[model samples]
Target: MKRVLLHSAFWLVYLLQDTVLEFVWVGPALKNIPEDVQFWMAFKAAIAAVLPKLLFTYFILYVVIKEIIKGNVRLSWIILQVMAAFIIIIILHRIVFVYYINPVIYGGVLKERPLFHVLSVLLAVMDIGFVSGVAITMKLLRIQLVAREREKNLIKEKLGAELKFLRHQTNPHFLFNTLNNIYALARKQSEHTAEVVMRLSKLLRFILYESKSNLITIEDELRILDDYIALEKIRYDRLTIHFQREIDESSGKIAPLLLLPLVENAFKHGASESRFDSFIRIHVQLQQGRLTFNIENTKENHTAEEIRDNIGLGNVRRQLELMYKEYDLQLQNEPHLFSVRLYINLTSYAQV
Candidate 1:
């Protein structure tokens, strides 16, 4: 609002100055001429006097001033000479129009006297004052635009760095959990421990390489989830783990490493340490430019004490807030089950 008011005030002042000058100087000078002819003549004179100086002022403000402070050779001399030449041109233009043109048409008493030199001096001073004011205004506007652009870029850079840091934190957290699970398997001397290690190696490789990108195909993220589930199933092969996906293969792009946090949270809080015929049902579907994910797990009857904290889920919530500020998120925990439901708009990018 302040900026709008300031700009409005500037334009008001500028137009008022030009209109007043046109009314005062040219309007009276063309008084004896026909109304239509006087209008055209005054308009032409105003253009001839103002256009060149206005163009020159803007060039000096935007181009010369921009380059002059860079310490170029003879810049000061060049600028001084340019200003002197511009003033001379403006003064000459005003003198010719006021003396010869206005006298021939308007037929005023001052036409007999040597009035061109006096009028030229006064008009030249006015031109210089107007040009100086215009230059300062242009300089201030350019500075404001540059400052705004710099601020926007700074914000973008900060968000990029923070998202990268969050991804880094998530990778280590995932590694710690995987290594701990592997250690437990080794302690038990499970026959399928080597297979779990191999699958984990592939998953780690995907995370290290693919997760470095700002964006990746949804298929790649799905493959990472598949690798993680394979590792999980090695430990829970006897229980049911139903994973379903109904995604459009043609639209496959998504933000890299975005979905894993949610999936990891579900597994961390839902799958591990559950008893009494445990089961996890995962559904992922993309429809009408939106992606929906639902994860539900049947909880143990009396093991509520084992799953109280929402560490991974809290991280997922914060990440969602950062990534999809406009999306919907709902998580519910009941006596028999824990579930998460999310619907994210993907129209800004390609959807899958």
Candidate 2:
């Protein structure tokens, strides 16, 4: 329906344009005729001349252009088709003008002209060529626009699939570590085992449900971080952890579960592996739509082989890259300390 309307509008404008041009060309010659009569004669001539032009334009647009775009017809065959159609359309337009238009507009006083006069055929060619060029240009532009839109959609879908796969990778890694914590408590027969299980369930529920969305409120994310920290704290008696938050609640939302993996990495490689007293420091600050998160943890002094990229940090990095265009992730690895700092322009994500 939209295409039909577009074609109709195109032809309507063409007809009006042809009428105005016809009136301008013939007005000075018909000085005795009234202005309204001269305009009526020009309009009627345009209407009569349009039939051949319309046929010629549609033939080239639908038939010749379609075959050329399909790439099935040989170049020689396409040239032959166009040349034959042009000759026939030119003759048809001349017959319409000489027999139909001239007789009516000149009151049958004008002498009969040959069907294939050189000037008339040349004028027909110019008329047909101009309109066909415009039509073909419009057609090619529409095709290019559609192609670009399709390519854009395909890229978006590919990225969405990759993100989902990354999330799948991340979810099991988190579950594995949390279940290990629970397993240790269960084996120890610790009194906090039941409470730990409850917290784990809540965390699991959030992961299974809330984390499905592309973004969630910053407050929701912080709440999940607090829950995970509390659950992990139950496993160790001497672990020192400090989480400081300075958040603007109305700032913006973030990708769900994007930060949990950083905290998980700290607990997995730093505090959990150290034999002596260990500490983890976390600070999350969001002000005026900018978010800065920093996490640091103490680890035992060991060889370089002991420190390596784990799944959690890698997952967080990948998510940040896919989700935010304006963001930074930095890692600082010392002999006894591992630190991560991330900065994100939440307003940019909002714009996206």
Candidate 3:
């Protein structure tokens, strides 16, 4: 639709330009001819200008300049064509000037002023060439701008696909770890084993149905996080988990399964490893089209091999980068503490 409007507008503006030229010639060329005929004469003179422009416009733009840019036309060849164009334009300009501009404006013969005539004719031809050059330059700029926009869109889509794949892979790895937790409880014949397995099944169903999607609402994700936290509580009675959502439930959406990895990493490395100081603190909220999620966990140390080798957190980071160009995710370590802060600008990237 935009292209159509631009195409129509270009021709409409060109026609207006030609009509202005006709108005300029009409006053001088009245010649006692009938009023209607005088108007036609002026219009014809304008056509003489526009028609000459058309002759070289496409030839220079499509054939000469395009081929040269594509490396299919050589420099020497372009030089020769330019020289030929000058000769042709000079002849064409003389014909139009002698037959149209001079006769209409001055009622004079062609050879009456040789030097003045040649200079005027050359100037007219060069003027047309100059207009055509400007037109081509604008066209080249538009083409380059469009190409660059397309390249940027392509990169964004590629990253989005990678993010989707990464998130999908996370589902199974998480399931594996949770199943191990359930298995340990079952081996002990603990009374909460059945309840834990039921909670795991519910979490699995949510991951299977919701995480497969391109986007999940903050409300739904928070519910999933709450359920997972319950399962963690069942796994370890001593674990202390603090979860808070400071925003409205229906605030915004995000790429699926994005927040889970951050929480999971905290619990696995921080709460699971530190028996004495085992706790996870989480806070989330939406502000000005952005979601800020902050999590801090008590950490004994950072040297756990599982914590260092984890790719699940890396996957979430990559997904955040792809889905939200305007986002901040920082994981920092302090004495007995592991902290994560993620800020996502949902307005920057289109929802899937």
Candidate 4:
């Protein structure tokens, strides 16, 4: 639509220049001719006037513009070539107008005058300059537009790479703690030890393979979360915790590893640290291309001098900024509880 409008506007300018402006500027000189003859002569002159300019403009387009853009020709050489071409074009245009068009239109060899010839050639050169100006402007505009599009694509690719990097950067501290849990279980020889190891294997596999992609099904993410929760439960076996999933259209897709950091934080600061009467609650709702993930957990209080390291939440927030242009994340730290609520618009991804 924009191209159509631009072309329409260009041709309208050309039409006005040829039909109206040409006659007004050059008509009074041909007053000796009949009115109809004057109009015909003016029309023929206008056509002949623009023909050489078109040829020169096309030469600039096909050869000069290409060479200049590619840096294959020096600026000084280009200017020299244009000047030499302009001289030849003006001379040929004057010759053609005097020998062919005027004799045929006037029915005789008109005055062989130098001043008139020089003036006409000057006018023709001005028209050629006009054509050159328009051609250069349009060519530069197209080049700029192409450059802008390439820049936009490059930015998208960079953002995508950053988001993937952040996802792949799973907390090393979490892994370190889980290994200690497995070591403790081995010493105890509990039946649940094998189950915990299997869960850990599954969690590692999911992180290494399934979460490699930028997008995955909500169901897949939930399963990853379940494995993680099970591992945490084994690590802190005596905590009273709740994980609730209220899912509709669980097949909805989202960026992988987005919600896991919040859950990890909940366990790190809430359920694992509390002495007694502690609880962690997680709720996930997926329906109609929208996701609401909420986690609230009982937290122990500390003064400003004592604060848990918050690098995990900071890193996840950065990843979310890269993945989503419009999303909702609320982190609330009340006196007794730490809560995180995340909302996402998933209309673009229906399945994994």
Choose the strongest candidate by TM-score.
2
Q: How well is each residue in 131-235 modelled by candidate 3, as lDDT tens digits?
A: 677678878898789889999888878876776678678988788878878888889898988898888889888887878777778888888888888887787
Top-down TM-score ranking: 2, 3, 4, 1
Give the runs in model 1 whose Cα sits over 4 Å from its true position: 1-129, 301-311, 349-352
TM-score, one value per model:
0.65, 0.92, 0.78, 0.73
Counted clashes in each candidate structure: 0, 0, 0, 0
The candidate maximizing lDDT is 2
Q: Which scores greater on lDDT, model 1 or model 2?
A: 2
The local distance difference test score of model 1 is: 0.69
In model 4, what is the error at residue 290, expressed in angstroms?
A: 3.0
Error at 81, model 1, angstroms: 23
Model 4 Cα displacement at 231 (Å)?
A: 1.6
lDDT per residue for candidate 2 within 200-224, as digits (tens), equals 8999999899888988899899999
Better of 1 and 3 by lDDT: 3
Q: What is the lDDT of candidate 2?
A: 0.86
Each model's lDDT comes to 0.69, 0.86, 0.74, 0.75
Q: In candidate 4, which residue pairs clash? A: none
Which is the better candidate, 1 or 2, if ranked by TM-score? 2
Q: Kindly report which residue pairs in candidate 2 clash with one another.
A: none
lDDT for each residue of candidate 4 in 1-352, tens digit (9 for 90 to 100): 9976975677456655774665665457666767776667666666666667667776787788889889978899999988888887887777667776667654543554552466666777777787668866897889899999999889878877766666656546557667877897889887788898888888777777888776889999888888888887876755777888888887778888778888888888887678776788988988777788899988777422433437678767787667666668887777787888888886643221
Global Cα RMSD, each model:
8.6, 2.4, 4.2, 5.5
